[model samples]
Target: MSEKNQRAHDLRMYFTGFGLAVTLTALSFLTAILQPFGPVGLFATLAVLAIAQVVVHFRFFLHIDLSRQAREDLQLILFTGLLIAIMVAGTIWILGDLMTRMM
Candidate 1:
C-alpha cells in the first residue's frame, strides 16, 4: 500500500482501539454501579473487561503484533506484564498480612 494509505489504516486502528477501551470501561462501570451481579460476579466482570482493554491498548496503541518486527517489543511488553503482576501480588500479600496483624 501507499504511504498515505498505511498511515490512514494505522490511524483507524488506533481509533478503533480507543473506542473499544472506552466502551469496555463504560460497561465495567455500569455493571458495577447497576449491581447487575453480586460482588464476586462484578469483580469477575471487571477483571475480564480490564484484560480486554489491555489487549486493545497493546494491539492498537503499542502496535505490538506477532510480526517479526514486533518481536523485541513483544518481549518487552511481556516483561512489563510480569513485573506488574509481581508487584500487584506482593502488594496484596503485604496488605493482607498487615490487616491480619491488626486484627
Candidate 2:
C-alpha cells in the first residue's frame, strides 16, 4: 500500500480503539453507580472493571503484544509487577508495625 493509505489505515485503527476504550470507561462508570449491593461488593466490582479497562487500553491502544519481543516484554512486565508488590507489601508491613507500636 502507499504511504498515505497506510497512514489512513493506522488512523482508522486508532479511532476504533479509542471508541472501544470510551465505551468501556462509560460502562465502568455506570457499573459504579449501582447501590443495591454493599460498599465492599461495589468497590470490588468497580476495581475489577477498572483493571479490565486498563488492560483493554494497553492491549488495543498501546499495541503491546506478546507476539513481538515476547521475552523482553514479559520480563519487563514481571519485574514491574514484582517491584509494585514489594513496595506495597513493605509499606503495609512498616505501617502496621508502627501502628502496633503506637498502640
Candidate 3:
C-alpha cells in the first residue's frame, strides 16, 4: 500500500481502539453503579471487559500482532503475564496460610 493509505489505516485503527476502550470503561463503571448483576456475576463481567480492553490495547496501541515481526514482543508480553500470575498466586497463598494459622 502507499504511504497515504497506510497512514489512513493506522489512524482509523487508533480511533477504533479509542472508541472500544472508552466503551469498555464506561460499561465497567456503569456496571458498578447500576449493579445490574449479582456480586459474582458483576465481578465476572468486569473481568471479561478488562481482558478485552487489554487485547484491544495490545492489538491497536501497541501494534503487537501474531505476525512474525511481532513474535519477540508477544513473547515478552507472555512472560510478563506469567510473572504477574505467579506473584499474585504466591501472595494469595501466603495470605491463606496466615489466615489458617491464625484460626
Candidate 4:
C-alpha cells in the first residue's frame, strides 16, 4: 500500500478502537444509572468492562506488544497492581481500625 493509504488505515483503526472504548464507557455509565443488576453484579461487570477497555486502549493506541519488551511491560503492570492492592488494603485497614477506635 502507499504511505498515505497506510497512514489512513492506521488512523481508521485507531478511531475504531477509540469509538469502541467510548461506547463501552458509555454503557458502563448507563448500567450504573439503570442498575439492571444488583450493586455487586453491576460493579463487577463495570470493573471487567473497564479493564477490557484499558487493554483495548493499550493494544490499539499504545501499540505495546509481547514481542521484545513484553517482560518489562508485564513487570511494570504487575508492580502497579501490587501497589494498588497495598494502597487499597492499607486504606481499608486503617479506616476500619480508626472507626472501631472512635466507636
* lDDT (C-alpha) at residue 28 in model 4: 94
Return the candidate ranking by lDDT, descending: 3, 1, 4, 2
| Candidate structures ordered by TM-score, highest first | 3, 1, 4, 2
Q: How well is each residue in 1-103 modelled by candidate 2, as lDDT tens digits?
A: 9999999987987787788778877876777676656788778877887777777776677766678666677678779989999999999999999999999
The 10-residue segment of model 1 with minimum total lDDT is 55-64
Local distance difference test scores for all models: 0.92, 0.79, 0.96, 0.89
Q: What is the lDDT for 76 in model 3?
A: 95
- Candidate 4 local lDDT, 1-103, one digit each (tens): 9999999999987998899899989989999999999989998989999998998798778775677867698678779989999999999999999999999
Point out where model 4 deviates above 4 Å.
Answer: none
Off by over 4 Å in 2: 1-5, 96-103
Model 1 lDDT per residue over 1-103, tens place: 9999999998999899989989999999899899888999999999999999989898988888999999998998899889999999999999999999999
The 10-residue segment of model 3 with minimum total lDDT is: 29-38
Q: For each candidate, what TM-score against the reference?
A: 0.85, 0.70, 0.91, 0.75
**RMSD to native for every prediction?**
1.6, 2.8, 1.3, 2.4
Better of 1 and 4 by lDDT: 1
Off by over 4 Å in 1: none
What is the clash count of model 2?
0
- 10 residues in a row with least lDDT, candidate 4: 62-71
lDDT of 2: 0.79
